[model samples]
Target: MASSLTKDSVHPGTPGTEKTFFGHPRGLATLFMTEMWERFSYYGMRALLPLYLVAPGGLHLTAGTATAIYSVYLSLVYLLTLPGGWVADRLLGPRKTVTVAGLIIMLGHLCLALPAAASFYVGLVLVAVGSGLLKANISTMVGHLYNGPKDARRDGGFTLFYIGINLGAFVAPLVIGTIGENVNWHFGFALAALGMALGLAQYLLGGRHLSEQSAVVPTPMTAQEKATTLRKGLIWLAIAVVFYGLVGFTGHFTLNWALIPLTLIGLIVPILVISRILRDKDLDGEERSKVRAYIWFFVAAAVFWMIYDQGGSTLSLFADASAKNTIFGWNFPVSWYQSVNPVMIMALAPVFAWLWLWLNRSGREPSTIVKFSSGLVLVGASFFLFLAPLSIAQDGHKAAAMWLVGIYFFQTVGELTLSPVGLSVTTKMAPKKYASQMMGVWFLAVTAGDSITALLSNPAIGGVNLDKMGFVALESVLAVLAGVAVWMYRGKVNKLMGDVR
Candidate 1:
């Protein structure tokens, strides 16, 4: 089995022979832990952001405003990964880029620990930029550990890596959420900062176990190219600043109005990026077909995440405002609801890993498109569970917590089928020269989803009012779209995937 692995598999030192971490490479342990803590910091802060924005001691913003900011912040976090991947592929390489990004994340959290509104916005900006730089490149480094596309363990390995991500996510809300909701928000932010600091420390200590390819630039830019790129970036920045300033001066710079343009950008950027990739002269016929197939997958994932990612904003608000937090007469913090999805992931991921492997051994494994379709259906169905609670609870009464749990359960199953699998498929289908950048492109689906989510959550801008029927209608439409994709394009997409399955 080891002999079947490519020469570049895993780390340079042991290559295919290493299996120190649960029958995978030793480096998986290091990368797993690094990602674990990064997620801890990220989810920890995220669990509090929407809640804090409406709390009296915090920003005291309205629900619409808070969710708008939350959605936009999350959108930019994924959106920036495109350039972040570019920087890694062309300049610093994954190892250095991830390291520097971690530091920036820590700094952002520290700023959030301060008690000023200006610092709060600054902290969000820093965290968004830093997270953007770190997210895709770190995932790319995981892909670097695999042998060429045929390595049977790749999906399972990514599943295990995803478990590490959920480990942090599971623990974060329990810890940081408790502190932020019960004690002080800034202290909770401070704890999140500490988590990032620890992540960086362990990552540096474990650097030796990683693949050397992670430190090598895939396509190093020449000095002239660097100069040109820098000039272009600065000019774009200047143009954006001037445009924003003019909007503010014209007295039409309300938060909801600002988000409308950002939502459009989110929708448009993916189209532009996909077009560029499809037109790249370097791609062969097979590669072009795969990219085309990926477009369907991308749209499917966007729909899935559009509904799934709402757990932090719309659902959190539901928990805080309407859900009864008592379990056996013990009241709990609403932020703790954030832990449910991750906890479900940790429990179910191993089961899924075994299921996929078993199915593969029998030559009956589902194609990626089938898995994606399943995910979309499950996540979209999770929203219908809300109707049950909404039906029973009347006269401002709180619904049982179990209803939310049920919703999270379905969403968790959907995420297991989709998110990690999406990561694995992106690594497999990426064009050779555009590898890291393709990971970024995958993240752009999340960007698009969150952008749409932001627009939908805000009632001031013709968004869904999120009433009982409105919520049901919005998710129902998404589910129907998912079904249409599978019904119309499944066979074509599977064929275009070439040998990927």
Candidate 2:
């Protein structure tokens, strides 16, 4: 909103004469279409996973197990970004890294299209790792496109990029979800794989347009450093093998095991990142405080995403089980409900973009912290809105479809306020040396939130009985409490940000 963010932290290259997409770099078009298709594949598969797991022809998992697996899958997708981001910065550049990851993602989706349990599990792992590799770097590359001190177009470019993300999301559920629910789930997965393939093809052909900065590792290691890194990597690989072997071999293959390790990592990674940033000998006090400020945003973002991401798990189940689906004798596939979010996002994104620009110009834009708190409040209120209609639903009667529509509307608004702003602020507040890693850390919040959403949706752990009035009420209260906490800390957090706004 402040209009001063630049691509220097990501690209650090001189502006070029290239003009291909919207009067910006030709690379923007490449990145835009690439991310668009990637998101389509990701969300298309996501819209089907939970339902597929519970379907008779599929895994036939219980609701708890289904949601749990979904949780781990989504969480790991973001969690692996920690290491993926490190790889991008220290070994492979974002370009090659994303390209390779995209290929893996395509293969992963194809694996899902196969009708085998082994393939399913393997596919999840591949996609998670591949998504981790691509997610953080792709975003950083977008930032790289407008690299300059005076680039006022940076935020607008990101806004346009964000719209592409929603565009993909908007179309996926309608197309893939409909096919998955109506045709066959595996076929649905194949469609997702095809989407990724298209994206990969485009990225390969268009690689020339990307900034040169994205093509080189930001911090190349010397031979000795590479040896040390390889040793550490092998050690970690061994550790992971042991962990996975134990988790897989044992009879205890519950989702809780998956959730526990990631939860611990989620907790620990932020502490280490913060400590690393604050302890940097290169950073002065102001920069150190800025890193500290980022931690607050990080936590608030996790809270928001945990609640918002329920749309894929708990809310998807609700759409199938509780919501009314009929419209003039046409029954909507439960998965189609997933489209409501991106549809609202597509319609309202421009309005939000305009609002932010207008507010920034008027010097009336809220600080990032307040905007985050506002998002928390709005998301919390959405859950409360669910209570009224759901609480009064007669036996055998589904809740009105408008309830979900309303819920997603509010969620989208909250998303507009917090998500784009969060990305902008993360780039702004991050120390230049740690920019890529910080982006991964920001995604870690999403990992934590998504994992938390799954954990809470587990009826055994959180006793999530959507049929009862208490569950929604409890979540509403917790969100409001989180919002209040953010509100109370707003002034302190702003001070820590040190003129970043």
What is the lDDT, from 0 to 100, of the residue 298 in candidate 2? 83
lDDT of candidate 1 at residue 325, scale 0 to 100: 94
List pairs with backbone clashes in candidate 2: none
On the 0 to 100 scale, the lDDT of residue 53 in model 2 is 88
Tally clashes: model 1.
Answer: 0
Q: Evaluated with lDDT, which candidate comes out highest?
A: 1
* Cα lDDT tens digits for candidate 2, 1-501: 111221322232434333445545667778888989999999999999999988888899777767777877888899888778888998898898899899999999999999999899899989999999998898888777775423655666677778778888889988999998899998999999999998898888877778887887888778999999899989999998898888789866765665667656655666676687788899888888998888888888888887788778877877777777877767888888888888888788777777776787888967777888889888988888877667646456678788888888888899888888787777777777876877888888898787776666565566353435687788788888888898898889888988787
Residue-by-residue lDDT tens digits, candidate 1, 1-501: 122422443443444234456656767777888989999999999999999998888899877778878888888899989989999999999999999999999999999999998898899989989999999998998887777677788899899899889999999999999999999999999999999998898889878878888899999999999999899989999998998899889987776666777777888899999999999999999999999989988988888878788889888887888888989999999989989998889999999998999999999988787788888888878887767776766566888999999999989998998899999999999999998999999999999999988887676776653535566666856775685677468778888999887
lDDT of all the models against the reference?
A: 0.86, 0.80
Cα TM-score of candidate 1? 0.94
**What TM-score does structure 2 among the candidates reach?**
0.91
